[model samples]
Target: MGAHQITIVDMDIVETSNLHRQALYTEDDALNMVPKVHAIKEHIARINHHVDVQTYYQEITSNNIEDILDEVKPDIVIDGMDHFKIRYLINEVCHKHQIPWVYGAAVGNKGTVYGIDFKGPCLKCLLKQMPSSGESCAINGVLPTIITQVASYEVAEVLRYLSGEGFSKKLITIDTWHIDFKAMNVDILKNHACEICANQHYSLLETKHQQHIESLCGRTYLFRYQSSIFEHAHHLPGEIVKSTSFAKLIKDDDYEITLFKDGRMNVYGIEDDEEAFKLYHSYLKALK
Candidate 1:
């Protein structure tokens, strides 16, 4: 715990939305469209020159999880993701290797944190089954204060675990808006028939998650997806609402669309997937 290394893995770039909760970036970073991992690495270096920080500007997919874990060899992993698909993957991988990890999540004014180690309850213990559908942070929205609180709790657990001190194995829930804090007992959950921890069956580790990539087979996905519009002159269409290295967003009253440099696109304003594909196809045809 005295001298340690940190590995930050995230494929996303800094945006106006991230500046609020994630203290690692600034408005300048959001405006300039800096990669999240790269920007945070710089920030950490400035704060502590001694700390060895490794950054991966890539997504946490099943394909590369093993390689990344092998290369970094972290003492403990932190759960910063909001998605469940990846959360389960992390739980399985960490549990399989007897590694400790802190799982934390924040949404709106509410947040939750739980310490997961080989002896403690794994994520599967909390939610016996994989949830069908979820409301993403993108849709539900999250408060910056809530995020900070959740992250702080997660860091505290990490410190405790590393120092060989007893950590809270219970689920810690907090609501910053209401100033409510509660530690829910997870004894029953932990003792339950958790296929993951009980049987040591890490299903996620054995199976390959099908990646639905829109990019062509030969084309490489951009490590840093930033739009030149963030720092360069642009002749793009629409209002040019948001620009990232990977894609340029153009939105108007009628249409909200994002066009990727890899020839992938999505139309969110429209409900129909076919219609969105058609719109992207027509736009591509026009470009040609």
Candidate 2:
């Protein structure tokens, strides 16, 4: 926990629903609509004044990841992302840069943690392709205890790596509800024919493979278009709920949308994929 500097990136706003699991935030933070990164930075400053916490209040995408990583120049990266697409992007970039990273995920009482040293099996080596069905905590429901448990293991791995103690080379899996724990040796799972780790291919870094739409927690969908929302605010067909220099929130009968300055849009109250895409295209047309 004694880190010199830390850089965090996120585009999400604090919500009351997440307060049970996300302990860093409070009801006041949610009421004020504080960005996750900002709230984390403020909280970290309160706890550890000496830790230089740099915050980027934006979503990580193929376009901006390289620049952000170059500036931060972190010794190691940690995975706190909700989606696999972004994790794959991080895997590509970190492996390319020869930076060590720890991966952790939790959902519905089950969690997994792994450390990637770049000298061994990367994430892509373990999972050859993206899982066909994406399971989220929003859909399955995650226990608060699992979150802390996974985080504790993740931080331990980080400490071990930083101290030059080396990784376990085993993927740790746990189910807190059932009191089940298992560690699978992943040394045999390393694919010698892996595209990213073995062949030095970074397919996720390509623009064509960039993830534009992602389904997030609580029946929310995030669309990352390449057009600034501020430019087309006047044309949007919705009641302006809130408008700020960084983002604009609009609400209609069907959906609530928050558009950021960087072109990322969070659409709430929609579950169907077709409906989400239809709304995104409508907004895209309006922006154009």
Q: State the C-alpha lDDT per candidate.
A: 0.71, 0.85
The C-alpha RMSD of each candidate to the native structure, in angstroms, is 5.9, 2.1
Candidate 2, residues 147-168, lDDT tens digits: the string is 8999989999899989889777
Candidate achieving the largest TM-score: 2
Would you list the clashing residue pairs of candidate 1?
A: 225-245, 225-246, 226-244, 226-245, 226-246, 227-244, 227-245
Q: What's the TM-score of every candidate structure?
A: 0.78, 0.91
Colliding pairs, model 2: none
- Per-residue CA lDDT of model 1 for 21-99, tens digit only, reads 7887999887766778888889988988898888887667777888899988888999998667788999989988888
Judged by whole-model lDDT over C-alpha atoms, candidate 1 comes out at 0.71
